[model samples]
Target: ALVYVVAGAGVLAGSGWWPTAALVAAAGGLALKAIWFDPWLSVGVLLDVGVIVAVACTWPASVY
Candidate 1:
């Protein structure tokens, strides 16, 4: 939830370390989810991975 907020702020601000923060947070959240919540095969888990990937791929172009 907090990761999503940071990611949203990063996208909106378009500068600073927010993008990297979002990327790291999202990845960490995904890892935590995998470890404690569900198997890697679950759709929710895969969605979390997708969010991490999306943040990573977009970070370079997004941050100023």
Candidate 2:
């Protein structure tokens, strides 16, 4: 869910630059919502999860 991304981002922000990824994820979710004709929330859901996974995997724990 999009809320998960926001909440996770908030927590991650407390740690470091991870908050930036969260902001990107949130923007991606919003963009999906705006660009999709049907506006299904699932599009944003996938984007948010993908962003979180991508950031988490690539960034080292110490960096965050």
Give the per-residue lDDT digits (tens) of candidate 2, residues 1-64. Answer: 5655565766656755545656576666667676774646776667767766767585545545
Name the runs in model 1 displaced over 4 angstroms. Answer: 39-41, 59-64
Query: Would you give me the overall lDDT of model 1?
Result: 0.69
Q: Judging by TM-score against the true structure, name the best candidate.
A: 1
Please report the TM-score between candidate 1 and the true structure: 0.59
* Residue pairs with backbone overlap in model 2: none
Clashing residue pairs found in predicted model 1: none
Per-residue alpha-carbon lDDT of candidate 1 for residues 1-64, written as tens digits (9 for 90 to 100): 6867876787787656675776677678777776787554477667767767766577456354
> What shift in Å separates residue 41 of candidate 1 from its native position after superposition?
8.8
Model 1 residue 9 distance off true place after TM-score fit, in angstroms: 1.0
**Residue 7 error, candidate 2, Å:** 11
Cα lDDT computed for each candidate against the true fold: 0.69, 0.63
